[model samples]
Target: MSETIRLPHKPDAPLSYQFVPGQGPLSTTHLIVYLNGLIAPQSGWRATIDHLRRRWDEGGSRSANHPALLTYDRYGQGGSARDPADDQHGGSHDIREVVADLHVLAQEIRRTKMIKDADASNEDDGAAAADQVPKPKLIFVANSIGCVIGRFYAQTYPGSTAALLFLDSNIANSDQVSLFPDPDAPGFDPHVLLPPDSTVADLRRTRAGYAAHFHPSAPNPEHLDRRNIISLLPLSDGPPLRGAEPDEGTGPRITVVGHDWATFAEEGLRGSMNVPEGLTNRYVNPPWAAYNEGLARLTSADRARGPVIATGCGHFIQKDDPALVAELTDDLLRNIEADSAA
Candidate 1:
């Protein structure tokens, strides 16, 4: 399914994607786009997609209400071409530019009949399928930095996003390392929350790892001043975030999901670096919870509802437990459909 199909796009930087046409009435069909973690490839979503496809087949075959599925590699990731403009811009892309690529890709998918009824013709002409039904609405199912991209995408293209399911978004607007307790800062107490085996060296190593992988724009795939976006879309306590189309009915019904505490400490932090479980529990978890909570409140509908904890999973919830992600996605779709009917 992952191929460089040469979908007519900017010749210099054509992205790669895996798209599956859906069955049933195409008018009701949604384009379920999977946005992978910052550095993770689109293939990371295989398990979740397969499980969701199975659920899509629950009622029937030819008349299944499954949404069209898509997963793509962003510029400089996986099989996609690199942004020629990156070198001029200090070898990183702006978050806004990355989202613009997504918008172009989505429009191309529709214009090229990428999401359509395949069985409408024997030859399976995409144009014929397109002639039969309307283009699908966008429903983003994103993870980590992908969630960041999704938000920008929705904002840029008003009324395009029908629903969103954010799977453990990154703590945007953060240095990520600063959230941890430093060993040398003012009034630093090493003995306070240290684990039995962890020492100052361990803490330093953890910070090093964080800095190497997660500093602002150096290692960050996109130039995301995450704080700015969060400020722009700060919860539904105020009026609609910035670009909300009043006609889009509450604007993108959003659901947030996050990793379990224990698993995240073990796999997300410790597995990657020398981070102590104590620091992770005390320092990182609270801020992470607050971040996801804030994300859930971006839209009016999901404001009161907190993030759905992925009890057995780590940062990569889909890989840890695909079934749960699939179930949540199916549930969100049904909710969106019901709202449309209402």
Candidate 2:
């Protein structure tokens, strides 16, 4: 079911959230939290969530083993309140603020679940009953810029996250080539061609543009150095990237899903920009593909899965192939279950 509720901490901004409870014992059911891309509402994930929920409910008696789904809109998007104060520069927020909001939301969910589990445990007496209280087993499904927030959250609260799925997500430092195109490349002259004075409003005009500019090649002109760019890469040097210290099994299982097609040319600012064919081929594609591969190796262990190419889709892979997303999510859940059983 869905509800529009205000967080006690951020009482002015109401968040639209949906919670689909899994069948059977609450203690064992995993919670899959869906984080939307830049400027996307929670409703964007409707098809995928509906498909997965239906599959879970219809899986016969084993339906009870399925994970619960939680999807929510961040502040200033969808049903949530928009803070004029927060809206400045190009966008409404920076990555850190969005991650903070997500942290609060996750904590609230855990708090509520703990209370419910406590109530459930009251019916029985024993060490086993005490164990009935649920420990958070959160699976994060992050798309685009949402991946940045997810990574930060997992790093900050390593114990809470069990798995992370990056769906057509961005990689830090990937924009270098696109932002600072090589001067030596054919038909490339940054000085000759006027860079469009694009704003967040301009990019939001189309989905492709939104995806392309979500993490602009250079958000600010002053800080384009390699060190600054590397520092800006999401989860590049965090506990999330390094995995939990002391080599405990608490690190999240991560997967990076990337679209095979060169979709930025379709509908966004990039399409409208009429960028030189040579520039797009030389500067854009290589770094993007390479960074995605780097994302696959972020974790120290073999826990990383795919820079998996989505054959038929573009940047919005979940929308293009919801079934594939569902399959991947289910597979991850099964893996988590197997590990727990072992």
Best by TM-score: 1
Model 1, stretches more than 4 Å misplaced? Answer: 5-9, 26-29, 60-63, 114-135, 193-197, 220-249, 268-272, 302-305
10 residues in a row with least lDDT, candidate 2: 220-229
Tens digits of per-residue lDDT, candidate 2, 1-342, equal 568766667787778898765544433446788988755678888889877766676773336676667899777667767643364533434555666677777667655654454465555552244344465567888887677667767665666677889887665654433343333468954445423443323222322432444445433221111223245554443434433322245466788888764564342324555443344444355666776776666564567788888877777878888888887888777767766665
Score candidate 2 by TM-score against the native.
0.75
RMSD of each: 3.8, 6.7
| lDDT, residue 21, model 1 | 76
* lDDT for 322 (candidate 2): 86
Candidate 1 structure quality by residue, lDDT tens digits, 196-223 = 6578888888888878787553454433
lDDT of 2 at 239: 39
TM-score of every candidate relative to the true structure: 0.85, 0.75
Q: Model 1 TM-score?
A: 0.85
Model 1: residue 309 alpha-carbon error in angstroms: 0.8
lDDT of 1 at 205: 86
